[model samples]
Target chain A: MSDAAARLAYDVIVDLVGRGSRVLDLGCGDGLLLARLMAEKGARGTGVELSQAGVQAAIARGLSVVQGDLDQGLADYRDGSFDWVILNQTLQSLVNPSLVLNEMLRVGKSALVGFPNCGHWRARWHLLLTGHMPQQASLDYRWYDTPATRLLTIADFRSYCGERGINIVREVFLTDPDGGRPTRWPNLRAETAIFVLAGQIEGRPRQRP
Target chain B: MQPRSVGIVKTEYVELFQPPNELRLDSGEKIGPITVAYETYGTLNADRSNAILLCHALSGDAHAAGRNNEEDAKPGWWDDMVGPGKGFDTSKYFCICANVIGGCMGSTGPSSTNLRTGRPYGLSFPVVTIADMVRVQRELMRHLGIERLMCVSGGSMGGMQALQWTVDYPEMVLSAIPIASAAQQSSQGIAFDVVGRRAIMSDPKWRGGNYYAFGDPPLDGLALARMVAHITYLSEVSMRRKFGRRLQDRERYGYDFATEFQVESYLYYQGDKFTQRFDANTYLYITKAIDYFDLAASKGSLAEALREVTAKFLVIAFTSDWLYLPAQSREIVSALKVNNVDVSYCEIESDYGHDAFLLEVEEQERLIGNFLSGVAREHGIA
Candidate 1:
């Protein structure tokens, strides 16, 4: 991600997270986001990263990060262990996004999910005109070497959450790398989508601040 | 830069629990006037906060680093990782390693003379548990004027002590690194220990643990026991790579009952070398202590057991270690997570099996060095 977009995402996350709350960052590369959450939001942060180098770097930063694969599920954490569980730009790469999303909700009261919007107008036009797989700044990898097993868009994620009874508490759409103002038609225009998701809480009284 | 050694160290002894002030064993027995042999590297900071206690594994002694004498051919067992610029980094931290109570290495073990009878205690010595070992180390710590340790770390049996230290004296430890170990000894481990003990007892020279007077200890039996235990310490891959069914000193089998295979010769050498430095009775006691170790036995669950632990943890495991499986370390990590303890766990890629903790020095150096520096920064000791 570009520096501006990354900073904007971090700012949004920091603003949404309550002060001094416990936060867990899944696939926290080098623990940059977790450190920012701790410093800017007073959040007690923990991280789980798969790469050995990432884990080492996170640890060197004095972050509590366990080296683990996200695909294996979050069985180490108990139900509602953290106030917020963040998975940034890593949802599409997951082998079982549905199971992981369920696990995230089970382990945290709220989850923040971010992913590239593959159904953007530019991507669609490129695929239609070129008769090849779509390639955009967000989803730049070729189909053969892409880490994303599930190519999803803003609309696809919204429908999936709705079908699974997940409540979208908040959301933001980035139309450009500069993190311009949130776009109205995120499904077709936005390059990246971020959402604050929670499990079914219709009848329950909200305890979160 | 090449790691500098602590260099030319000496073992020291301290006597604790004299007379009426006796150490109460888990078996409800009391033993007084215990002598603990220990070695220290680096200088203790003024506030005593820079102290890092290093626990030794099953056969390891207090000689954790540096050479005992100028002419000594070999340094301490863990010299590779504990030195001036190595993992423990004596230049930055005060490192201490104490021989366990039931050890043969200059500690008050079965070989120590029982003051009452002026004879080796042998089997008469009260069975010591891992908790008991930590208790002795705690007394040693108090004697040395250290109030809180910067970290407590070790691998295998030593890792058990590190875990026990956190649960036993949570406030005393700031951080912990339990490597290649388990919360409780697995049944397979117990089975091996049992067989080793049986081997020692079946020997005629063992004489019901009264072999000291004869001046001929159970050499063959002890060697056989070491041979068996050593096999568990190595992986099949390591064994294959190291010895691959090749003949020891001959091109072909001699068609006689002799150590023909290279693996057999290696085991024999390891067993023989072990007998030279270790006492058979001490091995039995130490293995028994390892078998009796169960961190969660009294607390009902591992999470509950570690609920009171306040120290940050760094738990490590080796992928090829079937003896102390990576799954066991995961159990520790899982329990620590349940309690919301700040923990870091990694299963290092290694083919060294259980011995990886001792042999995989480069990776350990990087992980431990980084982890300790981070802990030091948090404690304001950096």
Candidate 2:
């Protein structure tokens, strides 16, 4: 909701998008990332968001956005539509992330997924000391009214990816937007991470440091 | 640099039979002074009630039937269908065609002057919807003293605008025929248009929407956009049959991006020719409006939208049109049924894709002419 969080998302998108790939933004709020990708990188792209206000805002910004519900899979798209399909900070909010992610992989050759880490030290410490899920800056809502349907850890995600045979091409560990850089012990410390996954097996999938 | 002049294949303008005209845009912008570039063959009846409106498609102008002078070898694009005793029956109906707004022809669009700034509007033109296009046609008719049109018809984007007229203003139209049109543009449609616009803006010549001063427009981008669209207008089967593995003046590949196959050459020519006439900004606006189109979404449901229409309907779809499939046309028929509207539906079996509605002369003429005559008899148009 804050400007800082939005800017951080934009920066990550800038680093992830290729020079000339067709990009599709899922839950593309206001299409900020899409506009940047199209303008600066010469990438062709559009956004899908359910909110009419968000769609209108994106269109006014001269970015293409189609109003759509996430539950309806990306069946409308032909095969190999986009090189990159992005789901930024919207993975946990979906009713069925697995189904949506599968649809994403079906439509795009690769995907960039960024979400708050449930296994971060702060979150773990809160659960260890108290009995409730930690209310952090990113995941700031309480259990009673939070939009997050599932709380997932970095390890749990990687394990699930392996079980599904989804090749993880690139894994990025992140601290708070303004905080220190990520190092070896990311699972214990980093609050967020970005993963690039492909549906089929490919050479050197991981670009981990 | 010298300006290259190609040989004149065909060129002419259409004269307005009824001089005075008024046009109202969907944005509620109306025009009193009018100029229509149209061609005609037959005479108007004494009552002038046998007028048939012919809607033009996107990137198409108003020149139909023939040129300004009578000595041209070839006729206009749809001349085959709108002739004496033909599908349109120029002998019976005063067929009229006008270039749609946001069109590059004589009609007003982004390239047209702002009238206030005294400069080309460029991106400043207000976004006009399909309904706005119909409003302009209705105004043109009203100015010509035409009340209750005998039948309104067109294909592709023109069909889209015609459909809008039936919903937006049914009283003005007696019978409506929309060919190869979808009730709503799917998300994939929006995606393609978004890419096309992005391609145009990506050109350095685009110059952030101020390219008019540079004397060099974004021709490459516009051409690329057109090539992308041209692909959708044709069927895969047709493409395969016509240009499959046919080498372009060679036995093998050139190891470069030059036109290697016949298909590539055809597409390149189509795109290259298109950029010369179409305003890049108008293409952006019109295509965006098409992407934003959802007749059902506007009025809550397709049935709800058709409930407002008092006119009879005849909708047609091609079997091979992947761009706007037969299922989409059927959706409109289903909704019309729910509203208890008198509607006839037909899905023509053809391999011509979306272009079939434009290219197939005999079949289209027969269907359209018969439908119009039926509407005329019921409505008592002379």
**lDDT of residue A52 for candidate 2:** 46
lDDT of candidate 1 over B182-206, digit per residue (tens): 9999999999999899989898999
- Any runs in candidate 2 off by more than 4 Å, and if so which? A1-209, B1-41, B69-74
TM-score of 2: 0.60
Compare the candidates by DockQ and give the number of the best one: 1
Q: What is the TM-score of chain A alone in each candidate?
A: 0.93, 0.90
Q: For candidate 2, what is the DockQ-based docking class? A: incorrect
Off by over 4 Å in 1: A1-8, A199-209, B1-3
Query: After TM-score superposition, what is the CA distance of residue B369 in candidate 1 from its true location, in Å?
Result: 1.5
Write one digit per residue (lDDT tens) for candidate 2, span B235-333. Answer: 989899889989889998889988799998999999999987787887887897788688888678887888888777777788799888888887876
The lowest-lDDT stretch of 10 consecutive residues in candidate 2 chain B is B1-10
The window of 10 residues in a row where model 2 chain A has the poorest summed lDDT is A199-208
TM-score of each: 0.96, 0.60
Give residue A9's error in model 2 in angstroms: 74
Error of 1 at A103 (Å): 2.2
